[model samples]
Target: MAASVQGGRIGNLPAEANAFVGRRLELAEIAGLLGAERLVTLTGPGGVGKSRLALRAAHAARAGFPGGAWLVELSELRDPDLLTNTVAQATRLTEQTLRPLLQAVCEHLSGAPVLLVLDTCEHVLDECARIAQELLASVPELRILATSRQPLGVPGEHLLTVAPLPLGERDDAVALFTARAAAAVPSFALTDANRAHVAAVCARLDGIPLALELAAVRLRGFSLHRLLEGLDSRFDLLVSPARPRLARHQTLRTAIGWSHELCTPLERLLWARLSVFTGGWDVEAAEFVCHGGPLDAEEILALLASLTEKSIVTRDDEGAAVRYRMLDTVRSFGAEWLTGLGEAEAVRSRHRDYFRWIARQGEAEWLGPGQRMWAERLTAEHANLRLAIEECMTAREPETALELTGTLWFFWFACGFAEEGRTYLERALRRARAGGGPEHTLAVWAHRLVTVVADDLEAAESVSAAYVWLAEERRLPVPALPLTGASLAVRGESARSAVLYGSVRQAPAGDGGAEFFQLLTLAVQAYLLAGQAAFERCAAVAERLRAECAKRGELWMGAWGDFFVSLAGIGLGHPDEAVLPAREALAAKWRVHDRIGAAAVTDLLVVAQASRGEEELAARLLGISRRLWHAAGLPQLGRPDLSVFHREYERRLRAALGDACFTEAVRKGRELGPDAALALALGDTADAPGP
Candidate 1:
């Protein structure tokens, strides 16, 4: 199952939503180059339609390769280390295992006649080149079509440089303008009255497709004659003499600069401030980050509408909300203006503050019915959050950096970014230590969480020691202590975990919902390891926590509460009572992308199934759990309280299924994707039905 979009022919080469205007000769040459060479690199300036041309070429050339043509968008990717994983994901190699992700990708494409179209590789140029070279070397049948600002510089790479649309009597640029104008202004047409004027405008804009479209959108208000006159004046003012050789670049800059000059002061201000966002921002986010000073909160909506009208920002209607974003080139221009005005630091400070609040709110609300919703919103803003973190670090604002990084612990962990989260946390920690200040409670908590998530026992001990002192100094009942106990238990230190839990106490009733759930999780794990008497106590606390969560509408930890109940039922020999709660916990964790938690719950569900004498079903779930654990990047640290029974269940299932069948069943589970695994664990038959 390749990652196909809504409109595609062979594999995920997206069908053009808007009619492609004119790239006839370029397309012909590209097709020839692609056929002649296995790796064809498309090089061009920004806004020159490099990505569009590459995509069209890939789409047209799809039939040549039997395995299909696939496009992996690299514009939104910031981490080079994830290049292989991202490509694999695009190709839908969904198996989760401990193997190197690149090896998995090589295994998928090895000797397969496939065409991989890598778009926007300029940012991760080196990494993309390395990947392309490795992949092509191993898979002789693989062809790579990459678009970048320059060539990939790999061996045997064929370069095709894309230039702007040609002007003159060809009318290609004019045809493009006319088509877009008709969409923008339905009554608009290319007649003898205005055909020359439209051609002149296209000539002024250097026939750049992006520039022409941006200019075309303005037809809603301006007559052709007046638009041409205004472009003449703005181009003279914005054209830099130093870059005369780069005509298309200058034309694009002039076009964007002209758009900026046409904006109202408030619109311009909003544009500059909006540059702070890396991805896109909704009206709500724009209002929060761009308001104050001369721009009032109420005025932001009107100004944003104006910018959208002028094509300074593009509006995206995703799901239920409208998001506004600037193209990369446009955003860069705005950022330069912001820096010129000496408001760069101020604007980024506001950005960091706004997103930090978002992180804290998400942390507080993650345990409720809105858990999945918050996760989705946070995922959408991930780029902005990363930008904010970078701003904090670069500005030498350690306190802010520490707080922001710490606040995002739940988001990073629950969203399966544990390793990346650790990187940011460590950076912030070094900054804090350099500043010679005591670590704040929030920062300490964040570090401790990261340490535990990364399974770094040595770092966990250091972080917990620091947190313990900070919690006492502030007289705050840190929720992270019990997390430390869980980490200890994972390290096979049940006795030490028991001793640690002896000192850890539940937060006061009025403390917070998250803290209470944290306490309950510790109670269940720590006390169960302590023995049967402590296990009963743990059961009572679990019941209380579940009732309170249900009463208060807490969803995330309430599911964990369900997990605890299932655990108690297993320990108490009530397998029937365990099934439903185990399923409930699995569903909740799956919804929030809690891979580690989901894996642990799957293991518990298998125990319950085995207890019901369903040995085959139990064996299948055991396989699914292994897949889940691999996805989590964590080892199977068995539940200390039930390890004996859990092992016995595995042993009995292996004997019943036989070696070959058991291995096949496990492979079947490994093949079950995240969604199907969740469905199966929750008692729904997989899409194909049957194990």
Candidate 2:
């Protein structure tokens, strides 16, 4: 009933990779389509990963074809004149010139059973149409997988549209984000506090994978509510002309515009208002952030339901119970029009306030599972979270200003989000300090937080005076003592900070904040600056603190606990002993976008690695630390102190290792500071020095 591709052969491939995701059904469907059709064309809106799916499917079904499978990546070839050459390349045909290439491919595959994967052929649809027609007529036993935005205008070509993943199930987009977030931010898991919200965010993303990916990246900086708000206002910021071809395909704003032109006014406003979050938000956030107060709760609910029907907004699988999000594109489109309507500031104010409320809720939850959940939610809303801080600081809303800064502490430190955190916290502190009240306590908190995330300590050190002023002038009877002390210590008052923490520890810490924070002070004093015995003392104290935190179900401070433990391990000259905790700390810190935490722990990890003869790893990590530190405008690590370690590290490490800490910085890695960078450089040398 259908054409048979027999005796066609495909060539060698990259090691059958599994790094790719979500194509099982497509693969199967493609297999079935190939078995049943002469020519099959897979079509999607764009960036549907059609080529990837086709290649994977072809790889998997190659055995069935026996002649093998081949790929013609048509996306690169714009000249129709080069179509034959492109085909020749895909078939691996040698060409003295392009003259004989097409004929040569036709002859070469005459007796072979092969499947040809034609990727991204939409732009040159005519050329593809001609090629497919010619190849099928002459070769008899060839199958093709051609991807185009629209049909290739070829006969016998069956089209398959790859839609976004279904959000009807519980583990659809939310599950995908959960898996991807954990991958990007290791050990990240969906927690009860954010389960509903995360699901809602995923659903609103309309299950578009790339949109989902960008949202996940945002999780490194802000809350879900914060992300939503950005989604509300992003079109205003995201619109810059891209390369014409790319502008349509790559920009979320364009993608949403395509969808938004299909919506009504109220629907568009509803969409913009929904953008007031990074993660899912409650009905309260939506009503306050989106509606102009004239719209009652009931009317708003019905409008939201209407958006879901058009796929403009998606409620989570539990239906109306959860919060909502917009697909990145949808949100972008909504934001564009929201700005165009001159309602940007009015709506954005609502968006900011909603984030403030969410941040306060998140702050209250910082002590429990809520800590992780809200942290992740914030991580997804980095853009909006930042906007909220800017709005509050500019508007001089002291409470909102401080809380937005404080609420993000966990996320900023956990996921290595120090850069963004420092920006907003500084502005917030400036506002809080200018206002001059009990809010000064918050200004101190802001300064301390900014310091930790500041890659460049020099810039942050200027604010050290303010941290001290807060302690001297506004040190609350609250346990914010260690926080202030730790800030001061990091700014260079180590001995005094050690004593400051001692006072907090001495005070009867009846509950949560004091105990958890004071641990930071003691750890800083005993290990960061002290000798071997002091490290042991720090270790003992940290171990006790860790157990106490565990007993109270407070793992929020685990990164800090692990950081101290690794320091003790490194101080003891047992770098190997430091490895596990250091690695764990790095992973945990990254999980929550705690950039400073990751950097601090990595510094210790490098010390341990250098001590243990992992010179190459040390060198790589050292480089990373330096980059991170520089980005934060912080002062450099003691190059003189680190030189000895670097030299020693080179003596032992002849080979660098561990994917060099993410692909973009494979050579330099994102370690901690100059100390770590020196170690990494040493490790990179083939003839490294031995310990």
Please provide TM-scores, in order, for all candidate models, with all chains considered together. Answer: 0.79, 0.48
Tens digit per residue, CA lDDT, model 2, 526-581? 44444436777778767765665555445457666777787777777777777787
Clashing pairs in 1: none
> RMSD per prediction, one decimal?
5.3, 19.1
Q: Residues 1-691, candidate 1, lDDT per residue (tens digit)?
A: 2223223233666557588888899999988887778899999999989988888888788877766688988876666866776686567553332346576577666534789999999999999999999998888888899999998999999998888888874468898999999988999988888878999998988899889988998788788888999898877765468754337787888788777877788888889988888878988898888887899999988888888877788888744568888888888889999999799888788888888888878877665666688877887787788778887787655788887887787776566555557668878888777533434556666666555532455665665666656566546675545555655665666566654444334554433334543545544453445344455656666776677667656656677778878888888888899999999888877666566677778888888887887666777788787655544334654233444644676578888878787667666665554455566677776442243
Residue 150, candidate 1: C-alpha displacement in angstroms: 1.8
Number of the top-ranking candidate, with TM-score as the measure: 1
lDDT of 1: 0.73
lDDT, each prediction = 0.73, 0.58
Model 1: residues >4 Å from true position, as ranges?
A: 1-40, 53-119, 123-145, 166-172, 189-200, 232-246, 319-321, 364-370, 434-445, 453-460, 478-517, 520-541, 567-579, 604-626, 637-691
